[model samples]
Target: MTDSSRPTRIKVIRKSMKASPDQTESLLWGDCLFCTDAAMTDYDWVLVYDEFPRTPVGTIRNETEPLLCPPDQTILITVEPPSIKIYSRAYTSQFGTVLTTHSIRDLPHPGHTLGRGCLEWLYIKPMQEILDQKEFPKTKMLSTICSAKQHTHTMHKKRYDLTRYLADRLPELDWFGHGIREIENKTVAMDDYKYHLCVENHLEPHHWTEKLSDAFVAMTLPFYAGDPLATECFPQESFIPIPLDNPQKALEIIRKAMEDGEYEKRLPAIREARRLVLEKYNMFAQTAAVIHNHRETGTIRPGAMLKGRHVLRKNPLHALRELTDTLAYKIRSRGRRGTGTGA
Candidate 1:
């Protein structure tokens, strides 16, 4: 969809105070109609409740605040997740029984709908152009930053050791783990390398961590070790998946690619794919599209609501409040103890 067609009259409403660190109060809950300022006048919908409480109101009651433009004028898009427990409370409370949640995979049909969905990470950087300008070398056996935690793993250590053995066998093969100054530095250095080794311990397959994104952003081919579906989620043919069955075989394949210059011939295609992701899969555009779709269709999907349990005890706000109360009690008790000692 063209940028101009996207929703321009968006409004956010929230309780006057800030909510969670990740949530903006204005995006959660507030009254759009209450604002008289011209700058706030053009909003098409109002977001209610920045963060869903642990226990929301039991039912969708009329008394609950509406987060939208007056009745028919604009759409009322409620940002909710797919969890039945959360939705049950939200549906029973203020926003009414009708609700819809969407997933990141679901794009809007018409392209002008209003709603919200999970905005997954999409790294943006001019990797190809930079790589082209720098004229980076093509070398085998490239190792991107290995986190301290991964280095500590017995399996990971064994894999690294095996890779080191392979590197020793081939003199031309070079390994680099110099600390990267920034994303650009990493991207440029990665583009020069024949194959980027992206090994991670995260459970979710096809998940693109920032490091993997760096590979794509820099127009460098990746030998991914996590999530078999990682290639399916992003630009096709941009990455070479490290086989789960035989990771050593995958390394052998990478070794061949390095020696044969197959990695060099595919650079143009990888560069084009990276460009498409940058233009189409941007977080801002994706977020706006989800917001638009939700308002048009009042249905919530599995991923629309907040994921996992909202552990109240571990909450930062709760922890801070508890700490303050404990300190205050200790101070008061100390004063009383001093008074008793004197008496």
Candidate 2:
């Protein structure tokens, strides 16, 4: 909030922008965002939506309210993870198009990959110290890191019940690490585990968050139930896919993998996965690239088009269909105990 760095103007609208005499580079950081240490740098225009995933762009932009930035900026670079359509509509909207003179992009991100964010587990070598003390297990089975209190859907409820079942059904499966923020920092609890149930909020198309990151960093094979795009970084050999609908099937996969030493055998792929996460799938690098692109592109183009983007209003019918499909997913989720589950 220094004088040179401060925004010359400010408002709180999903659409519209107020004019400012100073065309200084501006950055807006949301307080409740998933990317705690998100990339923030000097750019002509930068907008960070902390709750982008929580809020739908089209729904919020119905009214022409003024936003928190200078009016008529060359660009309004947004960084966050939401449905692709949300970003598409935002870029094409009247206000979004105007403010985003250079670019109006909805770059979906998987939480901030900042600061050994997930790599802390491997970086600290908690498991190594335990092994040196002759206290760690020679061969561990499956383990999961549960949050203190939060479940997204009814399927989460059913999964919790199943986790309880397996806790007793197989005592060897160590499902610890709830309400232990200290353990999260050092990877003390995760090391030496052969497999990790890397469940995330949902099985999104391109929304794999820290679930896979943590597992890969710790060199543990992940029982993945998040985005399939995660495989883009690490192949199928690196992690196991868990069926969303059937907890029984997920249980079967884990049990089998651990018994036949398949988890142990996947060490090479696990090592490679860790390399990809650290090198390519880094949050700092990704955000820096977006900002760099903004600096390179200077202004907007003709006929409502941002300098590089062609602005066409999203199809009204398509918007309606997307809304209906979302509602359908929720309704069906309510009908069954084990439907549309996330980790």
Candidate 3:
């Protein structure tokens, strides 16, 4: 039996995900040590952050490998949205169980789709330090950060277009991200804003990303879009939803929220949501809870496993279709960039 007082050692398989402090042994949850070192052998459990296609196993970016541990001792978690089938479908042959996070407000479970997890896992330790304070003075009224990404997904295209529209009109808004004026960290800019324009790349049930979480951590109310199911996981009053279809109406809401002191009115709910993000929704905290549950139960049955080699496996026709779509998107994106109208 494992000792009750000792901190559990969890070997995290990054699978070419972003680098973080945990990649080299970091302490968290008061009793958990997470490390991404592939050579480490003395670990109680194996957790795989399965973000595939975009971040496939091995250096070549197309191959995959089996879980380091036996099925029972392994846990696979994917944070991508269901729209990205390539990411969701990658590395399926390696593990029997995968925990999906989109549906759960408190704990992760096996589900049909993968939604977003803490995309800010790389900076959670420092984010927690910033949130530890009780008050943050809002020097600015609103801001937003969006990357100039060209995606084949329709929702992604819409989001990028909307971001361009907002940036042009909202002069008071401090807009910055990839391909814009680069900021070293999101928290620094977020800390000074009263409200943040937090929109998702796609709109699906229970889908949300770090855009919302960053606002909450910095105690800035989010003028949020996407994720109709967000209220189920967070306080309803925590965010003001705007419709992407109507740019004028979205602007009106932002203007009214700022003029009417919406941040002050919603401060209570924002605090609650911030606590949820820090204590319950952060990736490290969620992983720690899973470890605790596994220790208490002393057993975790394997879920589903695919047979044969862990390679990029898909129907030839479907792959061809996707390839064609990507080429079309790239061509259109080039034209938009030439016209100075693309994100």
Against the true structure, whose TM-score is highest?
3
Which candidate achieves the best lDDT against the true structure?
3
In the order shown, the candidates' Cα RMSDs to the true structure are 15.5, 11.2, 7.1
Which 10-residue span in candidate 1 carries the lowest summed lDDT?
A: 28-37
Candidate 2 lDDT over 1-343, as tens digits, reads: 2244533222222222223324222323221111111122222333332212222232122222223222233223332222222344334332222221111122322222222121112234433342243232435666776544445542344445556655666666666555523354426545667778766543345556566776777677888776656665677799998875566777788788888888668878877787776555544334333333332333433332221122122556645644664454455445433223331
Question: Whole-model lDDT, candidate 2?
Answer: 0.45
Candidate 1 Cα deviation (angstroms), residue 96: 13
Query: lDDT of model 1 at residue 212?
Result: 62
Flag clash pairs in model 3.
96-304
Clash totals in order: 36, 2, 1
**Residue 1 displacement in candidate 3 (angstroms):** 4.4
- Clashing residue pairs in candidate 2 (N, C-alpha, C atoms within 3 angstroms): 11-68, 18-71
Cα-based TM-score, every candidate? 0.46, 0.53, 0.75
Residue-level lDDT tens digits of model 1 in 1-343: 1144433454433223223323331221111222212124345543333333333222112223233343222222333322111222212222321222322222122222322222222233443453344344554346454522223212345345544554566564445443312343454446456667665433232233445656655566776665455555565567776653364686687777767766677777567655645444333334344444443433323222221123332567655654554354335434432111111
